[model samples]
Target: MQYTGASIRKTAAHFNIPSFKAVSQWERIYYEQGKDALFKEQRGRTSKMGTKRPKKPKTNIETNEDLLAQVQRLRMENEYLKKLNALIQKRERSEKSTK
Candidate 1:
């Protein structure tokens, strides 16, 4: 009825339905997926089993040597950050003492 020159509001009113939005949605579903799509059970909330979470992709670090190299790099970064923090604290203390 909506596709045949009838307005959504008028069609909804004539059918004694609550809102024109519902009519519009039905028309959209009908056009997109056809009539069979309307008869299928609607899923309100997706169950944990129904949803498949995408897996994280594996990195190029496949060997033990690669893992060790990454750990060493992280350790070096951590040491650098610690040294920077200590320097900042020492500078602040010196400034405070001078004041």
Candidate 2:
């Protein structure tokens, strides 16, 4: 089951399992962590700490329309913020020139 260097040579000699490195990896895992660790159970990128899971998409038609309107409102807010930031920078530069 657990294949070491000695085991790899023995297995290769007797049974012809070609990858010694792969066999050695299996051996190390089995010896150190046991069999359950070898199985691939978890899938996809793990969520970061303190970050909430993304909300599921709304299936209801009314809810989807509401969300779309909210998204447009948020986009307008972002554009307003950008223009405000540019105005503030222009003011800062003007003040610096005056001084």
Best by lDDT: 1
In model 2, where do residues sit more than 4 Å from their true spots? 1-62
lDDT of 2 at 79: 100
Report the lDDT tens digits of candidate 2 across residue range 66-92.
899999999999999999999999999
TM-score of each: 0.44, 0.38
Candidate 1 TM-score, C-alpha based: 0.44
Q: Which pairs of residues clash in candidate 1, taking residues 3 or more apart in a chain or in different chains?
A: none
Residue 20, candidate 1: how far off, in angstroms?
0.8
lDDT of every predicted structure (CA atoms): 0.90, 0.78
For every candidate in turn, the CA RMSD to the true structure comes to 11.8, 15.5
Candidate 1 per-residue lDDT, tens place, 1-99, comes to 845788999899999999999899888999999999999887687665756779878876479988899899999999999999999999999999999
lDDT of 2: 0.78
